[model samples]
Target: MRYISTRGDAPALGFEDVLLTGLATDGGLYVPESLPHFSIEEIRSWRGLSYSELAFNVMHPFVDDAIPADDFRAMLEETYKEFAHQAVAPLVQLDTNEWVMELFRGPTLAFKDFALQLLGRLLDYVLEKRKQHVVIMGATSGDTGSAAIEGCRRCEHVDIFILHPHERVSEVQRRQMTTVLGDNIHNIAVRGNFDDCQRMVKESFGDQSFLGGKTQLAAVNSINWARIMAQIVYYFHASLALGGPDRSLAFSVPTGNFGDIFAGYLAKKMGLPISQLVIATNRNDILHRFMSGNRYEQHQLEHTLSPSMDIMVSSNFERLLFDLHGRDGALVKDLLERAQQGPVSIEDYRWRHARKLFDSDAVDDKLTCDTIREVFERNEYLLDPHTAIGVRAARNCRRDPAVPMVTLGTAHPAKFPDAIAESGLSIKPELPVHMADLFEREERCSVLENDLSAVQSFIADHWKHA
Candidate 1:
């Protein structure tokens, strides 16, 4: 499949080229030139396949010719073989019509592993063929760092560097990234918010000389189309379980960077029987406000109980705007520039159109903790702080009872032990076998300011011999 940049300035690229280059040269995210569709019969025929088999069938069209069919199939199988659950992503009934899709059964115990595991395999396949090494630099608020590190740490041809705002992430989240001791993995503790770290990563990507002289740099964040493509599979998996288009499904995604919800949008575009995509956000709710037609504004980031969603600027929202504006780069540029300047006005008609497919709600710390306590007491389901926000948002957006609602359980509750404790839920989720002694491990990381020059210098110093 050919991919095009949202900004429409970059040259069109095939899937492999887009995979290797995370962001387009024109400063836009890559999206498929055309979305592939599956007939209803094809969807029904996938009922009895394994998760890996189903993923291969769903994703092959997007990766057309990027990897040989046999190689890609093997990669999918190997990537998911280590999942703790046989079913990979399983659906459990929460109420009569409400269901929870548990997505934290992988080694890293977060939804990101579903994609990052496959990403690592894909990188290995491509790098081995080309005989090249890559340095993957990413910034995460919580889960992505550990998931990326776990995926790329021991790979022979890749070096991964992950940065997070020091002291802003949860204790378990921090440990998950720091505990992994690998020669190829480097962690950075930035003395700022996630946006600061993210900006530094982007700035490094834009530096021509630094990017050329250093080892090849790629990204594992949701900005990479491959990560978003991997996430689209679970949406189809959930839909098929609900009996396909014969019945509709609704998804409640606990979102921060907007990549997760953008996958839902792709699923809808690909003819999934989904009704509403409910975007669950914390107090840092730029997306929520934009959808509500109030204003699209970025304020100072807030450190909340659900620290993962503590983002004021949702990066993947640019991809949504690209589609919303009918793939017109000029219009997308204008909207983004206006948004960056101040709160821009969105017409009521446009807002209503968006509301048809997307419903949004923001949960504060108090409500998030309350929802955690209530769900545990009522249904005996312990939720992490992020998933608690999703449950609350899903409950509020229950406009249709006939359609089954699926709330994405993003991370294992154990990742936020203190938050779970504060919510009065007496549950201690066991750590994954690989991370059982995370707290005892010595961490190795660099401390950096948010300056672009400082980040560039660090890359140049370490990557000179790479």
Candidate 2:
């Protein structure tokens, strides 16, 4: 399968090239040139397959020519075996036709492990074959940093750097990334919000002359096609478990960067019978505003209880605009540029078409904490702030009561104890057995100014020369 840039200016590439190339040369995300559609019978046949087996079947079309069948199967098996749960991504029912897809059962205790664990291995395999060394640069609000480091720490051919906002993320989230000490794994605490850190990474990728030609730059962010490919599997997994193919399901995703919900969008395009997709957000709600009104604009970033969704700029939204504008790259380019300075909008017909499948709502801090308390009181289940927002949106924006509404549980509650405490619950949420000593672990990290030059220079000086 060939992949083309959303901006339509970059050259088309095969799956392996797309995996490593990440953002296209024209500063656009890559999407498949043609999505492989599965018929109802084809999807129905995959009802009882294991998670790894289902993953292989769903993702094979994208990576078939990149890796041999048996080798790819072996890597997938290895990737998921590290998950703490046997089901990998499991579903827990809350009420009739209402459920939560628990995605934090993996190594790093977040939904990101579903993709990053495999992405690290795929990059290693291709780099080793070509005898090339590369550098991975990513910025995270909370979970992605730890998940990426855990997945790629053992990689043989890459030096990975992850940046998170200093004193902005929860203590547990910061410790998870900082405690994992390795020469190849470097963590930076940027003195700004998540958007500042994300911008630095994007700017560095735009111009990589700082690396001095010794290494190629790679991405672990959702902008990488491979990460999105792995995420598509769980959407299929959850749907099949809840009786899919014949019955339509609805998903409410707590999204910040728009990658996770974008994966759900792709699943629907590939023939999953999804009735509705809800865009759940925290106070920083550019996506929510766009879905409710036609205006797509940026505002001041906010810090809420759910730090993971604290983003002003939704980077992947451009991918959706590329489609909404009938795949006109020039139009997408102009729209995005205009959005930077002020509010930008699309044609009324295009906006109305999007409103058909998508609905959205922005949850504030009080509602987030209240939802967490309410869910725990109703079902004896605790929710992290992010997942609480997802649950709230699923209920508030749900159009039908009969359809199964499954909110994507983004992270483990143990990872965000402050939120649990703020919910007025007396019980303390303990960490998992393996991470029980997380607070006691010695952390090593460097604090850097939010300046792009300082951040880029740090990576250049510390990167292991090829």
Q: Which candidate gets the maximum lDDT versus the true structure?
A: 2
Give the Å shift of residue 39 in candidate 1: 1.6
How many pairs of residues collide in each model?
Answer: 0, 0
Q: Tens digit of lDDT per residue, candidate 2, span 1-466?
A: 8988888799999987888787899988898888888988999999999999999999999997889999999999999999998999889998889999999999889999999999999999999888888899999999999999999999989899999999999998999999998889899999999999989988888899999988878999888999889999988998899888889999999999998998888899999999899999998999999999988889999889999999988888877888888888888888887888899888999999989889998999999999999999999999999999999999999999999999999999988888889999997888889998999999999999989999999999998883
Residue 65 local lDDT, model 1: 87
Instruction: Encode model 1's per-residue lDDT on 1-466: one tens digit a residue.
Output: 8999888899999987787888888888899999999877778888878999999998999999888899899989998988999989988888988888999999888999999998888888788888888888899999999999988876788878898998889888888898888777788888899999888877666664775664677889899999999999999988888787567899999999999999999988887778899999999988888886647888878889998899887889989888777788777878877887888765666667778999899999999999989988888888889999999999998779888999999999889988887886667777878778888899887888867777766766664254
lDDT of 2 at 72: 97
Off by over 4 Å in 2: none
Q: What is the lDDT of residue 399 in candidate 2?
A: 96
Question: Where in model 1 is the C-alpha error above 4 Å?
Answer: 211-214, 464-466
lDDT value for candidate 2? 0.92
* Candidate 1: clashing pairs of residues: none
